[model samples]
Target: MLKTILSISGKPGLYRLLSSGKNTLIVESLQTKKRIPVLPKDRVVSLGDISMFTDGEDIALSEVLTRLHEKQAGVAVSEELLKDSDALRNSFGEVIPNFDRERVYTSDIKKLYTWYNILIEAGITDFADQDEAE
Candidate 1:
């Protein structure tokens, strides 16, 4: 499941973008000039490479997830069968808090595969602005 999620949402701006160890989340704003800090569980517009090179450190999606957890903000994995842009636009939703195996088991496996492939097929791959912390 994790592999599938990464494979599809791997493209920028289509999921709850997370870094490896940061304390902030990079929520894309359509009306602002900066990526803001959101609760870990906050659904986000993850359509680009949200990584940042601050001073010298590289901030990647993995780091964002770490930070989200530290902030104690809830994050939900959206399985919504939406268009690429639509998926990015409404990325913010209820966070799941924790992804226990039992919780995932509740969903139908076939459905999961469908959503995963859809993203992989239609997700974007350009505009990964590295080092956004400039």
Candidate 2:
């Protein structure tokens, strides 16, 4: 699930891993369904590999997303909330109460919401890894 989804730096949206070659990985845009080759120089990060800073320990992105889903009742984050930095902080606080305020910037919150909404639109409500779920 999250393992196959990648975030390529400099790309506008999330991409789904399609295939791999010797020096490039094929990826399909989750938004437009367009296929493109990700070169070796491109910074590609798997969604599963992302984590958020917390007061005690780092929390996996999947866990944060799951908490967000439950908090929002699986609905997309509101545009109004997204626009206000304070509101975004407050909302994320509700999702992850102990999230490190100093480490998690407003931009990170915005990106998290954007990615969550995109995944919801793509009909991917399950954020947990299959092995973890079992």
Candidate 3:
């Protein structure tokens, strides 16, 4: 589920939590399908725990992704189009109208799109499954 998926800072792709060690967590890269150990010092966050700042309040990543999924009719958005910050912001704005422009950068937007595509390719589209897993 979404909770098991993580986005590590400075990492190029998403990882799936596999197991926990004494001071590290084993994770499998969604892109490479290779497993690696994440040290305690590494900046890691569960997709389920991530939220974006909005004008009124924080919006969960799940909500934003769900809205995007609905908007695109469950299909992945074009990666090429998402490369442009202006386009990314416009697309994201449609999903979360009040998302904080100052806090969310182009890199963040790209990461969200990349992660969403990875999730979709891995057949992790069941939002209900994510909720039940929590």
Candidate 4:
């Protein structure tokens, strides 16, 4: 689930939380399956904790991803779309029509697609929490 998938700042890719110690947390890279110790000083954010700005209220990243999954039928976003800002925005708008245009930058859209691709490549298609799925 998204809760166990972490995005550590300054790191290249997503990491899966493995264990915790008194001083550091153990994480395995989702991309390479390499384990690393994350210090307390490192900014670690779980994907479940992320949200996107919207007109009414913020939408959870997991929900956004789920919507995207449904919209694309699990197909990964095209590389050409990723590079073109207009195309990226158009694609994202189709998935999340009300995502705050002012707050969600082009970089954020690209990252969303990138993360979605990574998760898909890792065989993680379920973005909903277990409780929510039930």
Candidate 5:
């Protein structure tokens, strides 16, 4: 689920990791269904490998998303929250109260919300809970 999805630097939106090549990883755009070869030099990162800075320790992206999902009662995040920085920060604060405000940019919060919406629309929720159990 979240582990197989990726966000490449300089790319437009999310991509589904398809396979690995000699020098690049094959990925398909979740939005357009178009496949592309991503180089190792690209800042390609699995969503699962992402974590946010917290007061005690960094928390996994999946955990943050789970908190977001629960906060919204399994509904899509509001558009205002995505567009408005102040609202977005407030909402994100409710989810990850200790996320480093100085380190985490407003753009990062917007991207996180957008990615969560995309994953939810693609029916990628079950795996987060499973990852927590393990």
Candidate 6:
């Protein structure tokens, strides 16, 4: 079965969509390779994952949790369960974690434009130099 894996870009452990018929999420320990099954209805909480304000594709954790709540899905993991935990996964049907992208990282248009020119000057985009605007 195809599983959607979710994880911090630099983290080791991954949250995987294992089975959905019963709404189960599989949290796998990348180091020990241990698998922990989590249910959406099991109000659970976790800590130490260290997900930051800029996590989840620049989206905050609260937003993700909010969407989950609207669907009647339990908070799933209680804070007690995740105090010393490593990671989490979503195993709902067609598990596709939504993300909020209203805010983007700080950047200067002039700086970015200049940087793009630098890349072009360095011949990084040599193949597609058909239009400098690109």
TM-score of each: 0.22, 0.97, 0.87, 0.96, 0.88, 0.24
What tens-digit string does per-residue lDDT give for candidate 5 at 8-32?
Answer: 9999889998999789899998878
Q: After superposition, how far is residue 72 of candidate 4 from its true place, in Å?
A: 1.5
Over 4 Å off in model 1, which ranges? Answer: 1-50, 75-134
Best by TM-score: 2
Please give, for residues 51-89, the per-residue lDDT of candidate 3 as tens digits.
888988897887878887888788888977676889888
Clashes of 5: 0
Better of 5 and 6 by lDDT: 5
- Model 1 weakest lDDT span, ten residues long: 1-10
Q: Candidate 1 or 4, higher TM-score?
A: 4
Per-candidate clashes come to 28, 0, 0, 0, 0, 8
Q: Write the per-residue lDDT of candidate 2 for residues 1-134, one digit (tens) a residue.
A: 99999999999989999999999999999999999999999999999999999999999999999999999999999999999999999999999999999999999999999999999988899999876788
Encode model 6's per-residue lDDT on 11-113: one tens digit a residue: 4333344444457666654334567776665543332121223324433233333333444243233433233222212221112233222232122212222
Q: Give the TM-score comparing model 5 with the true structure, all chains together.
A: 0.88
Which candidate order results from sorting by TM-score in descending order? 2, 4, 5, 3, 6, 1
Kindly indicate the candidate among 2 and 3 with the higher lDDT. Answer: 2
Top candidate by lDDT: 2
Error of 1 at 128 (Å): 19
For candidate 4, lDDT tens digit of each residue in 1-134? 99999999999989999999999999999999999999999999999999999987999999999999999899988898899999999999999999899999999999999999989988999999876788
lDDT of 1 by residue, 1-134 (tens): 12112222223323333343355544432322234446546543332433433334544543434343333233323445333533432221212223332333323222333433344444322222344433
Error of 2 at 83 (Å): 0.6
Ranking by lDDT: 2, 4, 5, 3, 1, 6
Indicate the residue-level lDDT of 60 in model 4: 92
